[model samples]
Target: MVSITFLGTGGGRFATIYQTRSTGGMLIEDRGRIHLDPGPGALTNMARLNMDPGFTDAVLISHCHPDHYSDAEVLIEGMTRGGINTRGLLAGSVSTIDGIDGIRPAISDYHRQLPSRVLSMRAGDEADIAGMRTRFTPTRHTDASGVGAVFETSAGTVSYMGDTAPREEVTASHEGCRVLILNVTRPFGARLRCHLCSEDVPAIVERLRPELTVLTHMGVKMVEQGPEEQALRLERMTGSRIVAARDMMRLDIGDSLRVNAPTLL
Candidate 1:
């Protein structure tokens, strides 16, 4: 079985600065634990939720933005037992692996040395990590080197649209995923460059038609407008199963995805 846990759901500058929502990303549990993004408060959030960073087998960073990769190195240390054991895979984009266009590399040389394998990926690239096939997908973002990710796991194909503006390539790349996670940072009609707004969800959902669509990485405006209401709006517009991600929200994916709210579960 495959399960996903959202450690944080906040996105954009203001939300991250004030922490209107947490920036720590999501955790995927299957054959092993895989931490995605590990942004600010990742370790703290994980600790609060009783998640052990030391057991993480892989860390996937989609970009170099502080809100996405700030806590990566610390997690790397946890995964490697404070450098005692050099084990775990670190996969990320060119900008994240090697500084690009003046954006500093997110992972330092010291941390890079600790991971058993460090994969510098680009759009169309694919990597096989512990039996799961991960394919890099294109993105339109300020960080030109940023890319989305799709994982073909035992349960099904899980796609993360990283931080990107709505693009045909993004939709097409995530076509076969059973679970699609999008970083929808704004409410409908509040379009922003390089980030998704609720207005863009319907088309993307229609194009990909994933069994489950999760909206996450919400900005201040999205939070103020109510992510759940926005999700319902998107569902009505696209006839797709849509849910707004909340911190620590978990979902078990099998033939069908089952959402397990922390309070309820």
Candidate 2:
């Protein structure tokens, strides 16, 4: 079985700064523990939930944005057991691995050396990690090198949209995925460039028609407007099972997907 835990669901500058919701990102447990986008509060959130970072077998950063890679180095340290031993994989986009103009590389050279192997990924790149085949999907964002991901796991295929605008390529890339997670950062009618809004969900859901759709990475506007209501609206429009992600929410995926109610930790 493949299990996923949402450590944080909030996004945007204000939301991340004030921490209206946690920004620690998600954890995927399959052949091994995989940490995705360990942003601010990642370590704290993991500790609060009694999740040991030492067990992580890989770290993935989707972009060079602070909200996506701020705590990555620290998580790498944990994965490598304080850098005492070189271990695990670190995979991400070109900007994340080598940085773009005016943007510092997310993972430092020292942290990059700690990983057993570091892969500089681009759209359409595929790599095997922890027995699963992962494919990088393109993203249209401020970080031009940003990419989304699709993981073919033992249980099923899981797709993450990362921080991107809704594009036809994304729909094509994520087709046939069992679970689809999107970073919807704004509410309907409030479309923003380089970021997804609630208005974009229905089309993507309709195009992909995944078994389940999870709405996460909510900004302050989306949060105040109510993610649940937005989800319900999208479900009605697309006829797909939709749910809003919350901190500490757990999902177990096998023949079917099961979501556990959020619990305070």
RMSD list, candidates in order:
1.4, 0.9
lDDT of 1 by residue, 1-265 (tens): 9999898999999999999999999899888888999889889988888878999999999998989999999999999999899899999999999989898889999999999999999999999855578899999999988999999889989999999988887788898889999999999878889999999998998988999999999999999999999999889888899999988899999877899886321
lDDT of 2 by residue, 73-99 (tens): 999999999999888999988999988
Query: Candidate 1 — which residues are off by over 4 angstroms?
Result: 263-265
TM-score of each: 0.97, 0.98
Overall local distance difference test of candidate 2: 0.90
Work out how many backbone clashes candidate 1 has: 0
lDDT scores of the candidates, listed in order? 0.90, 0.90
Candidate 1: residue 190 lDDT (0-100): 82
Q: Residue 253 in candidate 1 has what lDDT?
A: 94
TM-score of 2: 0.98
